[model samples]
Target: MKTKPLYLNDCYIHQFQADITEIGDDFIVLNETYFYSRGGGQPGDTGDIAGIVITDTKRDGDGKILHYFEGDCNLSSGQSVQCHIDWPRRYAHMRIHSASHIVEYFLFRHSDNQKFLSSFISGGKETSTYEVTAAITPEIVEKIQHDANAFIKGNHDILLYPDENNPDYRYCKIGDIVYPCGGTHPKNTSEIGEISIKVKGQAALGKQKIVTTLMP
Candidate 1:
């Protein structure tokens, strides 16, 4: 079943209506969904389907988004239902994810777009880290943090549009930087708040991990 991802078009959509397309032993697929299913290092969405609590959502083999219910499950295919995504939780992921990239923008600028070896986001509201092979000096670290915060303060506009040649892939444009992304983000950088960077020692052969925390 092909599920229309309403969230892809509008991340701020918290509630919507849809019909049940299919039902599995543990999950139900919706005709359309604004609730994001886990992918791209982001967690899946949790919410309710017609007042029944939903614990998690995942993508099925055919790419249909699955909504998993909590202790009780009482939904069927072809049934009309209302969807409510946990706005606070979903918004946290968007903010934190955007902040990390905001910091990453400067990180790559200083190092000329090096590959991030490994990265992790702890919980939905904690420090996120990414490892890079670029040289991590004290002065460089300070500069990256400074520039990132400044950009956030500027509230630079962020854009999302599908690639003309390949519609399945979406690109996020921030200033002159454009990269392929499908993750939800704030309309502007101002929502990312202040970002703090902690330079860590060598994590591998020559790569270093930078710990990022969202500060008030």
Candidate 2:
């Protein structure tokens, strides 16, 4: 069965109950799950299920959310399990994901309509990256950082909801800017705190990789 993704609707849900539908050698597919499967530049979630350590969560080619766990697996299908996601880690991703959007918003305002090519959230809260189609000189990166921080400091409310026309799709709106996004995010910009940004490197022949991190 395709796992019902609970995280899409509520980013703050750290714990949930799910029924195991399928069990693999090291992974289990749930009838529903709160785990955010790895995709769209965000890393997979890791936590625990019935005292078992879930090493990672990912979607299979068949569209099942596979909860991969460490050590032995004695669980059976149709078994109900209590699950708990590592809140700090998931919250960190939310902050970084939201901060990345803020950075992209300002980057667009300064980069002369440069395209946001791609992005990635590392496993840790320390860093995330955005790939753009422009050279993105140091001056522009600095300007974007300043503006992004200003926007974060404004503590603007962020809303994530399904598209009016397509419930399967999602959008993230902060202030007056709206972005097409499906990743998790904090409820307010203030939760992201301050962020530091810099040019990481070239991701492709013509794409520049910019890195952003939550500031101390």
Candidate 3:
């Protein structure tokens, strides 16, 4: 199995020493990695692995994570290599991801008659969009956005716990609010900064497609 360092700590950006476990025609599998593979709606990390620009990262069906390089490298299996992540990009993702959770949390709380089924982050140049499952109106979207920012301004703490029994575990709590999540998030809500949401067309007859964006 491929070692996933990001799961242990989302903030980890540098791994000076890692062993190359396998290499393929277009990718290399590391014995350990800090790169966050594409999952949970969050984008995979972009950075350098053994001085080669890592263009993409993904996990295979067998759970083996692969790092694809932009250029050729003299790396080999069992060879020690250094890994470095683009901290600013990853941090931005963390902030936006946390904001998304807050938005979902309040949307559910405010719309007690409704429930949130899913959410995903769509990356862009200067901003990331979060598509959430909810039947929200424009006014309700605005209220939820405002309330989420209010919670962010309050600087509520965010925590992550890895359960061996339930490896895919996610739970967020803000005061009396509590919800389940499996994605990475910021340490505190304040780190999320300003955010906005645009209510898109309906996903179905009753479901709304809301796109939440982090303001620049």
| Order of models, best lDDT first | 2, 1, 3
Q: Positional deviation of 51 in candidate 2, in angstroms?
A: 1.5
Query: Any runs in candidate 2 off by more than 4 Å, and if so which?
Result: 124-134, 202-205
Q: What TM-score would you give candidate 1 relative to the actual structure?
A: 0.88
Q: Compared with the true structure, what per-residue lDDT tens digits does model 1 show for residues 1-216? A: 789888878999999999999877778789999988887767888889899877888887787898887565777789999989999888878877777777777887776624666565644443334455555777877998999888888878888899999988998887666767888888888788887888776635565677777775
Poorest 10 consecutive residues of model 3 by lDDT? 124-133
Write model 3 residue lDDT over 1-216, tens digit each, in one string. Answer: 656556446554455568899988878888778777787777777788878888877888877888888556787888988888777777777777777766767766666544444556655212222333445677888898888888788878887765658865756555445656555567777777888877665635555555777787
Q: How many times do residue backbones clash in model 2? A: 0
lDDT of each: 0.79, 0.83, 0.70
Task: Write model 2 residue lDDT over 10-74, tens digit each, in one string.
Answer: 88998999899999889989998889999778888999999889989999878799999877988
Worst 10 residues of 2 by lDDT: 123-132
Residue 29 lDDT in model 1?
A: 88
lDDT of 2: 0.83
Q: How many clashes does each candidate structure show, in the order listed? A: 0, 0, 1
In angstroms, the error of model 3 at 152 is 0.4
